[model samples]
Target: MTTVAAELWDGPASEPVLTTVRVPVPCVARPGTTLWHLDGPCRCFVGGPPPEFAPSTARG
Candidate 1:
């Protein structure tokens, strides 16, 4: 699992909410494997995809 920072926006009028979330990391070239690829837009947010994301340095 990998942690990342997601900036979610409810709407144009509302400010973006920054939060941390854990997503599954894909294996090395595994066939029929599925994982949350963080290279693009994030679908985990309720409102919509996050406009920005980055790797989190915080440790558990």
Candidate 2:
């Protein structure tokens, strides 16, 4: 999996924080990253922005 450069901007302006991270690239609608939850690991995300990908129609 290709490592993806990412960041998380959270909180107010004065306390705005960004989490710079490297995650495996995700599928068109499924990112290759997951959140470690107390009740086992999870990968289902809704709002995380997806990366750019070359669609099949665009691929040679």
Candidate 3:
């Protein structure tokens, strides 16, 4: 488990507030030469803004 600070809005009229959320870290496994699997797909949550609302970042 990992805790991260995030901004969340309760309602449309409410201002966004900073809060701490517990996110489960994903576990990955690769078996042999051709098998790859994610062990916790159900425990995953999207941790960032949607792609349409994401801020631009510089990539090099």
Candidate 4:
């Protein structure tokens, strides 16, 4: 398993929570977490390819 950062989004009525997930490729999170591969626009309902794994660039 690898460590990757994720921005968990439930729905329009909720906010996004940035966190880390340790899992193999092609994985899935809970149910409503909007998953997006850091490598690209690849979408995952639960989990998928782990991103490059990095902190938010906006926080320079």
Candidate 5:
């Protein structure tokens, strides 16, 4: 259950309205909308170690 969408138009075709802003944000989209930065940025984990097999195959 993860959603991020924007199509809230209230002007056109003698007002053929359509509104959808599945929320969770500090709002800013009301002049011609389309803005999605949904749950973005908690991604940075780079530290590597694991791959060591050579002491003539480590087995006396």
Candidate 6:
């Protein structure tokens, strides 16, 4: 588990407040690192970004 400070992106410039978030082990991955999840192996970027992977194509 990891604790991180996250900012709320609601409305224009007010006092910036950070929220503490605890991410479960499986859900957390290093930036630009590859790991196997329920969706197979993929390269994880950072912070709510989608993972990058190539779909497997069967050959006849």
Please, what is the TM-score per model?
0.20, 0.29, 0.20, 0.18, 0.22, 0.23
Kindly list the per-residue Cα lDDT of model 6 for residues 1-60, writing each as its tens digit.
333434555555775555544332332464444422333322255334454433346687
Winner by lDDT between candidate 6 and candidate 5:
6
The per-residue C-alpha lDDT of model 2 at residue 25 equals 39
lDDT of 4 by residue, 1-60 (tens): 344556665555565555444333322343344333445433454454553333344754
Clashes of each: 0, 1, 0, 5, 0, 0
Q: Per-residue lDDT of 24-56 in model 2, one digit per residue for the tens?
A: 434434445332222222234555444444334
Worst 10 residues of 1 by lDDT: 23-32
Full ranking by TM-score:
2, 6, 5, 1, 3, 4
Best by lDDT: 2
lDDT of 1 by residue, 16-59 (tens): 55545544434323324443345433444444343332356689
Better of 4 and 6 by TM-score: 6
Look at candidate 2 and tell me the lDDT of residue 37: 26
Residue 23 of model 2 has an lDDT of 49
Error of 5 at 20 (Å): 7.4
- C-alpha lDDT of candidate 2 relative to the true structure: 0.45
Ranked by lDDT, the better of candidates 2 and 4 is: 2
Residue 30 in model 3: lDDT:
19
Winning candidate number (TM-score): 2
Candidate 3 residues 1-60, lDDT tens each? 233344566555565555544333232221222221122222223443211212336688
